[model samples]
Target chain A: MTSTAAHSPFPSGRAVPTPVTGGRGGLLASVVGVAVGSVFFLFPIYWMLVTSVKPPSEWLTSPPVFIPDRLYFQNYTDALFNWGGLKGLVDSGVVAVSATAIGMVLGTFAAYSLARFRIGGTNLSFFILSLLFMPPVAIGIPMFLFWSALGLVDTYIALIVQYLTFTIPFIAWVMKGFFEDLPVDLEESALVNGASRLRAFVDIVLPNVRPALVATALLAFIFNWNEFSIAVLLSRGRVTTLPFILPTMMESHYVLWGDIAAMAAVGALPVVIIAFLLQRYLVRGLSFGAIRSE
Target chain B: MMATRRRPSRWSGGRRFALLTVAPATIILIVLSVFPLLYSLRLSFTDQQLLSLVPPRFVGLANYAQLLQDNLFWSSLGVAAAFALSVVTVQLGVGLALALALYRLPRYQQFIATLLLIPSILSSSVASFQWRSLFDYSSGPLNYFLGLLHLPLLSWTADPRLALPSLLLVDFWQWTPFVTLLLLAGLHALPASVFEAARVDGSSSWQILRYQTLPLLRRVIAITVILRLIGAFKVFDIIYVLTAGGPGSATESLAFYNYVQGFRYFSVGYSAAMSYVSVIIVIVLARVILRYMERPVGRPAADVPVAEAAV
Candidate 1:
């Protein structure tokens, strides 16, 4: 087979092979490997979806039902309304959205400064990056104590504040990388043409980085949405997120497997959709632009 | 007229603007992160308990002393280390193999890779819940399938021997895609010219991979390993949901232990000490990895950017 693909980094590195034709056996092995890997990767998700729609009887049946006898849409409603999953979902949405919005706004400014002005030098950027490596639990513990002292536990503000520590650094780093790659001449030219720095940034540079901004926001949202440890510790009753609620639901009497499955499915659906839709930007965002596909 | 006059001093004006723009984030990080870090450092030295009536008392080194002596503390550290080591190894191995396989088939690579990326994007708690149900002893499809094959059923979460490994399996299933994508990116970034040279010299695929591809991919592999290692060290959500360090604390990681002590037991001071110890280990590991990453392999050190090197 030919091995000349373009060098675009989108959808991952371009597929350039070694021009060696795989024999029939090699071809068969490749197909089998891909198939098995795909199944292993997808089965749990498939099971979650199927189990969410299954009746309780089929849920526990031997030779577990691959497809439900009847599609039970009630499981979702029961999960959302009766099981308090609605509150969890709303809480997660609020925290994630607020955290992402705050992180992006603050991060964009810091990133721009670092990118354009070299504010605080390179050491400052590295310092921010190092914070990303610190385990959230380490930070979460003292924050828990501090928030309790301030009577801020179980409040959205408490969670959002802590989430900023993580999201801000992330947004700053990713946005810095994006800003570095953009040509400064446009902004500089605008500045020379009587526009203020702020005006030049908003009018010229911001439009250029809009895609990166969206990608970073989505990624930050995902991180907050998936966050469990800090949320679990900081929020007890009033601001319980979906992830925090799942374990509690499991701990309660008469474990409702169907409802729990429905909750998990519903909770994961938006992220899955966002991931699929924004797969390209997702790659760049996750890597902090270290592996951008040009 | 005043605004236009001030424009000539734009250099200094820009500097002030930049600092103003950066201050909110820097200040927020300091208050939220740096302050908590300092507070936790202080709390680690005190005799503090959330459930206690008395205020915290200064008890320097007492918490650390007790932590060092506690068998559960030591055991949890071991468990965290083992979990991190095993998960990183397994994920890297499986992920690299899959990446290699996927790299060959250019036709179906994107479609399959996107499907593989699904598990990685899902929240750990949600993934844990899904896996928890899948591993359910009585009703899980895993056991059902085992029964169909006339194999003995396994209690995945309840069995002490299996609980940690079960958590590992869930993590492995979820994160291997991340490693795969990183390595696949590395593989794609390989210089095709080198591969062409090897092929022209009549090198077999295996020979090319071992002598050529593997050596070139070392930096990426190191990166993937370090990232996964750091993540695995902080694993809490999956274990928290799957077993809560259950079946006799068999699955308790260091982070989970900290969670239980601080939140469940209200032993604030002790948990703070544990957090400090964990943070030290992570920072030390990151430093060591960064040092190793800086060592020049075929290329000059200057060729790798500082940001990428640090990453």
Candidate 2:
């Protein structure tokens, strides 16, 4: 019912036709506006890079340098290996991989079933997507005790399972939408040709939706990779994820921005790159099914 | 397929497999996701502490009563509301503006879009700690930058008044793109004909935006607002890392308050009750958003004018 509104913003980026009397002024204003906007948008990332490269001397200097004199590569090198680097990396990697694996292998089938099968109602998709709307703190404490009772606290399994509360519902809901947008005739033809349903799904339908599946897995991986609170709640120092570890570095008086920046930059690199590369699907993967209003 | 199968008394392979395969994940969700939730519901009524094995004595209305009378509870609610409203509104405004600006910039749109998506991908804690140096009072970049403009030095975390807004600024910086992305999608999905028709008929940009784009985007805006609001309401990780609801609860969102009450103070029942209250607010907010999106905006009534129809 809502689609009939008539005016559009003319796609707000339209180059305003300059007036002759104020011609240069209008052009100059827009140019300045663009530069200001670019700075505002980019400054934080720029700061992140700057801090990572700054020598310990310039890390917290007065009038922080927009550019550093010497490239401080050691900051990154130190942050990683300082806190039992390989071990921290392994722990974080284990938790993230485990969570993403669980999300993918199990979430894929449920998502496929939800998309293809008419389960309970036409609006089941909305119901599923709405699960992503839940705040994690909603269940964090309860799950903490639950996992503790299972003697799973501070273990990899506890954190991995907790990640499911987020990744499963999100992956399922998003992949279901991606799957629905796929033409069903390819799978139907396979069914008609006497291949079993599972085979057809694996060989035919899956290959087609592989981009989205990869995207979902990667997104799920990133979510787990970056998650801190649950890892903190369940795993104090025992199973520290990268995010959990980074914050503890600030507790000391000589807060090393050189190392923190290096770690932050390095840590953010993989997911940030993935997010950029697969955003064609990952952005869609985020609330594509979620925005269905029913 | 069910109809086509002979001996239909037996379940078809697809149906059987789907059921069998789906059940494990469903069961896990029930056990891990739903059961703990239900468990928490039960615990909210009890006098149970973490270590206690003795069955929780049913405390009935006491937990709820305590939460009602709790000063911290009220303050927390206020904090949460302020954070949610301020942060979400700023982000929404900034995001909408950015999206509009970038929408017509065909050449730079892709680069800007990628940059915009960074916060969504970066863990908030990572963003928080990285930003900690930026907000440092004495020698930080923020003050240094302000020093350049000869502006008064601002204490971001140290000053009680500024702490909340400081955190909000962080949230706005990080999440505006999310709002932009959602609104951008809505912008993309809009039909071109309506805007073109208005343009052809000599409508000005301001009138067209007011009369046209706003109405068409109402549902998307509502959904984005709701999602972002709920998210802001639950703002925890970043704030926890940077401020920890610092300078005397200035940045204490409801979720953080609940965390403190339960974990720090060991007031489990009171915290549980607080959680229940917050959950109700979130559910209502979400439902309102959901309901708002579904309501008829442009479905023409007999009396409404074309220009004002979306309103």
TM-score of each: 0.91, 0.87
**B248 in model 1: Cα distance from truth in Å?**
1.7
Residues B245-304 of candidate 2: C-alpha lDDT, one tens digit per residue: 788877787888888877887667667777777667766665665444221211212111
C-alpha RMSD by candidate, in order = 5.2, 6.1
Cα lDDT of model 2 by residue, A88-132, tens digit: 678878989998998888888887776665342334434444455
Q: Enumerate the candidates' DockQ scores in order.
A: 0.45, 0.33
What TM-score does model 2 achieve against the real structure? 0.87
lDDT of 2 at A11: 24
lDDT of 2 at A235: 76
**Number of clashing pairs, model 2?**
2
Please report, in order, the local distance difference test score of every candidate based on alpha carbons.
Answer: 0.79, 0.70
Query: Model 1, stretches more than 4 Å misplaced?
Result: A1-24, B1-14, B286-311
Q: Report the number of the highest-lDDT candidate.
A: 1
Q: Looking at model 2 chain B, report the run of 10 residues with the lowest lDDT sum.
A: B295-304
Candidate 2: give the clashing pairs. Answer: A7-B212, A7-B213
